[model samples]
Target: MDKNEKSKPSYNQDIIKIIQARYGYSQDYIRKSIRGDRTGIICIMIKDEYIRLNNEALKVIESQLYKL
Candidate 1:
């Protein structure tokens, strides 16, 4: 993705609201490396390099946003 595209939001509260309202809840689960904690929510901190490196993953995210 380009710089402008990368500037867009991915995992945030607004998206979370839309997700819950539309899909009800996430079926996918993620296990965090930290202390063996698991969460249905996908967390992303702004300005994180991983967000830029794995931007292709955002396609599904963008598609879901279109449903809102």
Candidate 2:
């Protein structure tokens, strides 16, 4: 089987872990937030923004927002 077909059942778990790691959220919280999530848009947004952020500026911004 191809990769997508072989991993279909584990996709949700994989997504959950990725979100949790990135946001420092618990697995349960991520699961609930994404229960009806559409097309992984939230995850994609987060990832895209993450890539665009500079390490130093991101730290400053996060600090200002009390994110760190």
Candidate 3:
């Protein structure tokens, strides 16, 4: 792996898949969020951007919001 690849933390694929499938978010977005980017999928909900979300996405967003 390259230095950049080695420096980035690895996230759980299962959780990423769950979030992506439920939120319709791209893998890149999910990966960024997992790596501490706050402007990922949660921003869609916060800004009320009219994106459709699955049940799990709603739950995940709620949980994340509480952490803030």
Assess each prediction's global lDDT (C-alpha) against the native: 0.39, 0.54, 0.59
Per-model TM-score, in order, reads 0.24, 0.35, 0.46
Better of 1 and 2 by TM-score: 2
Question: How much lDDT does candidate 1 score?
Answer: 0.39
Ranking by lDDT: 3, 2, 1
Taking the tens digit of each residue's C-alpha lDDT, what string does model 3 give over 43-67?
Answer: 5452232223334567898999999
Clashes of each: 0, 0, 0
Best by TM-score: 3
lDDT over C-alpha atoms for residue 60 of model 3: 90
Cα deviation of 26, candidate 3, in Å: 0.5
* Prediction RMSDs, each to the true structure: 12.7, 10.7, 9.5
Tell me which residue pairs clash in candidate 2: none
Better of 1 and 2 by lDDT: 2
**Which runs of model 1 end up more than 4 angstroms from their true locations?**
1-10, 26-68
Question: Which regions of candidate 2 are displaced past 4 Å?
Answer: 1-11, 36-68
lDDT of 1 by residue, 1-37 (tens): 6655545333544444443454444423111211124
